[model samples]
Target: MTKNFDRLLEQSLDELSVQYKTLYHDSDIEGMKPLAHVDCTVLKIHGDYRDTRFRNITDELSSYPESVNELLNRVFDEYGLIVSVWSANGIPLYAM
Candidate 1:
């Protein structure tokens, strides 16, 4: 069964927001927001280190550990979602 964009967006935003808040060290930070496309989503961490420590952590493709893919796939399998995290400047980080 295919899920709609609203449902997918709500699910992703709810689950990942808290995790990112802690990871980025900013209470307002939320990761993985829905893009304009129907099925696309992007990680929403800012590039400013003063606001978040995730810059170095998410700078390279290797920064996202294999476990992230495994977890995201496992958790979001119902929606057939493949996460693609992008930098603030629009660099693709990792996809899985």
Candidate 2:
């Protein structure tokens, strides 16, 4: 990633309080740096509890934001998803 884009991603991750986006590196003195061990990106499709934002029963069939949609699309197309879904009515669906 470009340096500028890296900073931007870090800023956005911080704004969302995403704990996985960064780590306190022993080699780095400037504080937390982007996680470099793996190319893992965590998507909050179910929303975040820190800000008390979550998807409800009604939201089960609702569309996600464009950005989320794009990521979801790209992830399914590229990295693949291992999902365990809870139905709107609270039924447990097997992971795929």
lDDT of each: 0.39, 0.46
The per-prediction tally of clashing pairs is 0, 0
Count residue pairs with overlapping backbones in model 1: 0
Model 2, residue 21: C-alpha shift (Å): 3.3
* Model 1 / residue 64 / CA error / Å: 1.3
Report the Cα lDDT for residue 20, model 1.
21
Candidate 2 lDDT over residue span 1-96, tens digit each? 111112444566578776543221212213423334435454445543343344545755276566556545765776776665556697987657
Judge candidate 1 at residue 80 and give its lDDT: 59
Candidate 1 residue spans exceeding 4 A from truth = 1-51, 56-59, 82-96
